[model samples]
Target: MPFYSCFAHSLIQNGYHYSRKSPWTASQNIAAVESLGICHSFVLHCIISSFPGLPLVNPIPTKSLEGKSLIIRVFIEQFYENLEEATIGRWLKAEGDRVGDQEPLVEIITDKITFELPAPGSGVVRSIISREKSVVPVGCVIGLLGEPDDPLPDVSAENRATLERRQREVESQALIPSPETVAPEASVSERVRDRGKVRATPAARRVARENGMDLAEVAASIGGGLIQEEDVQRWIERRGSST
Candidate 1:
């Protein structure tokens, strides 16, 4: 009989001969079987070793709710940090009220920012998720607007003009100098100052600060003399483990 030097074949043969043999280590078995193009079997062995007899099944599909009323999620401002101070003012349309397209549904304010959130389509205001004075972030669902059994009439031209005037009045009251005009020179100076200060990025600085870590600790380990996010993360992990 020709002796097969194949590890997987040898293990299979031995496994049968010694039925009561001690179980082979996963890593050893995987290394042996993997060379024989038994990738699926190797993966199954690994999974079984890690989580014995756990049922594996594909996820079921979710039922689609097509033709449902459009939901508009509003953010108070363009940035995420403003969420802490943002406020949702009184609802322009009451809950369970029908509204037309482009109708002002709510007034949102953050920092010096104020704007009207318009109804995306003609629908009844089914529910309000966020109450007045509540701070909401970007992409937050503040309310649900659903299709009305009988939609309200579209806004007349005269009412549309009046609404436009109201919008203009609000815009005028909340106007602030554009960022570009207000900080053009300061922005340039800050960029130049930041470039000369250190090699670390702003994100890395933020991470270091939040973790109560000193940037100097990271500077000591990196050979390139530049502080990086990874260095900050590693420092954080080591510090956490030590504590």
Candidate 2:
């Protein structure tokens, strides 16, 4: 027979034997047996069934910028290339300050050309994102100023394309040689000729000329040959004593 049928037959035989010796009513005995069977089924299910795995949940907090009045976004100079020591002149706005639209935020000077960068809108200067003397690329944010609840202005694809074009133009200008390049124009021949004509003390000259040595050679030996009177005297004394 099937396992369940065999088990039920055994339970019926035990119940009949127990009923003959017990004084309980038929309904009460049957109810008690059914309750025991239910308990056994629950235990069996608990042992045989595998539990389902649950995934973990994480909560993240949101950032809020609510009540600020103004934010200034300082952009890099469109025409400026390298930021030399003299590029930054002065700051027109301070931290935690209020400013008007088109007001000067900073003065920048490059190669004798000075520019006053204007504020984009009227609002309090919330923060200075870039420090003084820092070199920032064109279109990079240097500061942010705006009302607290105002959403950040998006740099759209078109605006980004324009900024990139302007940046390329500025970079092309920077690639051009500056006037400082003219300072190194003196040729090697000019330097050698200048060195050959350098004046020396009489004694040094006598020693060099007598030894059939070039003054340039002597100067090259004695660290650029700025021959002092003492050097000349020493050379003369050494020459006389050597003979």
Candidate 3:
């Protein structure tokens, strides 16, 4: 019997059956084998053994791999010890695009310089986990590659946690107000509640108090800023003019 016939017989004896109406596709075969807990490498070895010395076009490195899969995860590597985070400049290869070994896959922008990240192996890009112009920490899973129908593995737990932590830090920093942008209303109530101890120079305070004037009124006229002695004199002049 031919090798194909023997292979079919083996599958049938093992209780595995395929639809006769249409030929079984590669994906369907893989799914069936996975459901039966059959190793893919074993099946490949049988095929290779059947046809001795014939070159196979399979993307999987069968010689180097035992039971390992062809799925490859692309990580954001740290170029410098001090570079903990980086921005994803762009993806050179989109999802579903075939890439060559060591070809430029994406651009990583750091504080020091921007560089292209190379593909670790030859395969079709399965997914782009990180978005362009987004920031992710070193060691985070940025992309994935594998055969068209191959299953992708989950991102590393450690990398996911680090990415989440970095995102939270960025969000927290965004929520904080800058020193120059801080509103006067933040401390306006405290200053307003204590009119006697308003934020004004001693000379301004003495002049206003001796004239039976409220420092709070002078402070308000200057847009709730500190009441300098010159500011108080200007308010006095403006009041005299308005009267």
Candidate with maximal lDDT: 3
Per model, state how many residue pairs clash: 0, 10, 0
lDDT of 3 at 195: 76
Model 3 misplacement above 4 A: 1-68, 156-158, 162-243
* TM-score top scorer: 3
lDDT of 3 by residue, 1-243 (tens): 375575556556555443344554343343333333444333343343344323212222323223445566677766778788789998999999998767899999999999898876567999899899988877677887777877666666646676787788879999999875787665665565677656898898888877777788787777676788888888888888999
Q: What would the per-residue lDDT of candidate 1 be over residues 30-138, giving only the tens digit for each residue?
A: 3233223333222343343452222221112332223222332222324444344457987888888887656898888777677787764455786677788877544
| RMSD to true structure for each model, in Å | 28.0, 29.8, 15.0
Clash pairs, candidate 1, are none
**Full candidate order by lDDT, most accurate first:** 3, 1, 2
* lDDT of each candidate versus the true structure: 0.52, 0.50, 0.67
Error of 2 at 145 (Å): 2.4
Better of 1 and 2 by TM-score: 2
- Which residue pairs in candidate 2 have backbone atoms (N, alpha carbon, C) closer than 3 angstroms, thus clashing? 68-148, 69-147, 70-145, 70-146, 70-147, 71-144, 71-145, 71-146, 72-144, 72-145
TM-scores for every candidate against the unseen true structure: 0.31, 0.34, 0.41
The better-scoring model by lDDT among 2 and 3 is: 3
